[model samples]
Target: MFEQEDALLTIDELCSILMIGRNTAYRLLNSDAIKAFRIGRCWKIPKAAVRDFLEASHTVL
Candidate 1:
């Protein structure tokens, strides 16, 4: 079960959490690398999706 604190977040919230610019966030969303849901005109992203994106995009040097 997911906690309330771990619930889906809005684009702005995700941007703040990821410390990325709005354009970058929008690009990520557009590319579908970060899963998002459209609610009317706003986009919402689950916390788990963010974690998954970070994991999937991680590169080992």
Candidate 2:
């Protein structure tokens, strides 16, 4: 659902959007629990990757 021209998101943005704490988000990103890439010292997480993660980790409710 992310329609920004640039699909990449910073760690802070990811945390804000996902409603998770910084540590949890970093842990997930660092552990490859979600897809992410680095440019210099910053992370660039794709919106699609987050969507995929949620979809894959969702449980029936």
* Predicted candidate 1 versus true structure: per-residue lDDT over 1-61, tens digit per residue: 2356757888788888789999999999999999888889899898899888887878531
How well does candidate 2 score on lDDT at residue 56? Answer: 79
What are the RMSDs of all candidates, in order?
Answer: 2.9, 1.8
Candidate 1 clashes between residue pairs 3 or more apart in a chain or in different chains: none
Write model 2 residue lDDT over 1-61, tens digit each, in one string. Answer: 3877878888888988889999999899999989999999898999999988888789533
Model 2 alpha-carbon miss at residue 31, Å: 1.0
Candidate 1: worst-modelled 10 consecutive residues by lDDT: 1-10
Clashing pairs in 2: none
Task: Give me the runs in candidate 1 sitting further than 4 Å from their true place.
Answer: 1-6
Compute each candidate's TM-score over C-alphas: 0.82, 0.85
